[model samples]
Target: MKRILITGANRGLGLELTRQYLERGDQVFAASRQPDAATELQELQAQYPDHLFPVTLDVTDEASINAAHAAVRAKTDGLEILINNAGIYPGASADEPTNQRLGQLTGQGAIHVMQTNALGPILVSQQFLDLLQNGVKARILSLSSGLGSLTWKSSGDPYHYSASKAALNMYMRSLAAEVGHYGIISVLVDPGWVRTGMGGSGATLPPSDSARGIIRIADQLHTEENGSFLTWQGQPVPW
Candidate 1:
């Protein structure tokens, strides 16, 4: 069984991924900012006591990421999969003026979004590099968005969210190049417009469906797929 680590495991896609991985008998390190307060995660832990490990990890905070690494290291010698799924969709609705347009975007809002969505994964990956290097056929998957695609910028709005995701894609691309020789496949995945808090209630796809598709694609990833930007269904997405 693969040893997997997923951030933002308290809800939505992260939660669904955790559940699915545990069901398949994988050892899952479910990282959340408030593990004790996560009722659903706690329930999952009860169901899969031997396979599920809830860890306290705040992606935006470096200290928390280090603490999480230490905690995971104490349990397992390595990690086969690292899902950088913790992210914030600040100003997700167009009604929020801060993310409406370039002119309306606030500096603080953009910075915060970049820190969480772009830099967080980098920091977490750095902290867990040692464990990943020791893993068998290790893979690092970052949850990106189609909005990040420069070729698909039909309507340019939500400056902070869009730009942050774009930056994340670039970072992951570079990371893939750097870590390829180590037998690690690093890539960005677009989970589609799933019905989650970030995706909004009007979204068509369900979180479980998106999670399943992503897992399937992740399972097939290898050195040849490094640096690729792909949809949940394993279709290639233009960077």
Candidate 2:
């Protein structure tokens, strides 16, 4: 079974990914900001005692990422998959102050959003590359968004999230180009609008469906798909 590590495992897509991976008998490191807050994961951990390990990580913090890497190093020599799934949507209120308009995002808001949603993945991937390289087969997945698509955003409600995701795609593209020779596939994926705190009540998809699709596509990625942007449904998305 492949060893997989996922960030922001407390809820939403991260939690569901943990469940699916563990169900398949793969080892999973379910990471969150507060490990104790992972009530569902705790329950699953009890059921699959040998398969799940809970880890605490706040992606915006460098110390947390380093600590998590150290913890994983203690348990295993390497990881097969690293999924960067943690993120935030600061919304229009947080964006308005910088631009002095309701929909216009501010500089601080944009920077903060980019730091978490874009830079965090890049940093985490760098910190864990040693472990990934230790393995025979490895892949790094970044949880980007459709909002990040420059081609699709002729109009949108989330200025901050969209801009950050677009930047994230570029970062993933550049990194993948550099790392492809290592037998590592770096991919950016959009999970679509699922019914979660971030996706809101009107979202059409469920976490289970999104996670299933993501896992399927993730399992199928190759060096050819490296540096490409794709949706959870395994379709290519514009960068």
Candidate 3:
């Protein structure tokens, strides 16, 4: 079984992904801001005590990232998969979004979103690179969004969220170019609009379906697919 690390595992898509992976018998390191307080994770741990490892992490901080890396390192020498799933999309649930609008965009708000959505994944991947190299068929998959695609982007809404995801896509692709020779696959996976807090209640897809699709994509990836941007369904997404 693969040793996998999933960030933002307290709820939504991250939690689903963790559950599915554990069901497949993989050892999962579930990372969250307050992992001890996550009741779902606690329940999962009770069910799969050996496989579910909770990691406390604050994605926006360097010290937290380092500590998280250490926590994972203490248990395993390598990590076969690293899913950078932790992210925030502010104002997605708001009925009247003030910060996401064009005129209402504030630098402070945008930076906060960027720190979590874009910078956090990069830092986590950077810290985990060595363990990934020692892993068996290692890969790095970051959760991106359709809004990140310039070609697919049609709306002017949620400027900060969209921009941060776009940055994440580019960062992961560039990282792939540098690390692919090491036999580590790096790609961005888009989970699509789901019925999560970020996706709101109107989204069509279910978290289970998306999470299943992502695990399939992660397992099937080859070196040639290292820099691709794909849907959870494993279909290529336009740049």
Top-scoring candidate (TM-score): 3
Which 10 consecutive residues of model 2 have the lowest summed lDDT?
92-101
- Candidate lDDT values, in order: 0.92, 0.86, 0.93
TM-score of each: 0.96, 0.93, 0.98
Question: Could you tell me the lDDT of residue 18 within candidate 3?
Answer: 95
The alpha-carbon RMSD values of the candidates against the true structure, listed in the order shown, are 1.5, 2.6, 1.1
- Candidate 1 local distance difference test against the native: 0.92
Q: lDDT (0-100) at residue 148 of candidate 2?
A: 88
What candidate 2 gets wrong by more than 4 Å, as runs, is 92-104
**Evaluated with lDDT, which candidate comes out highest?**
3
Task: List model 1 lDDT by residue over 181-212, tens digit each.
Answer: 89999999999998988888999999999999
- Arrange candidates by TM-score, descending: 3, 1, 2
In candidate 2 the C-alpha lDDT for residue 73 amounts to 90
- Per-residue lDDT of candidate 3, residues 1-239 (tens digit): 99999999999999999999999899999999999899999999999999999999999999999999999999999999999999988776666454978889999999999999999999999999999999999999999999999999999988999999999999999999988989999999999898888788999999999998999999999778989999999999998
Q: How far is 168's C-alpha from truth in model 3 (Å)?
A: 0.4
Taking the candidates one at a time, how many backbone clashes does each contain?
0, 1, 0
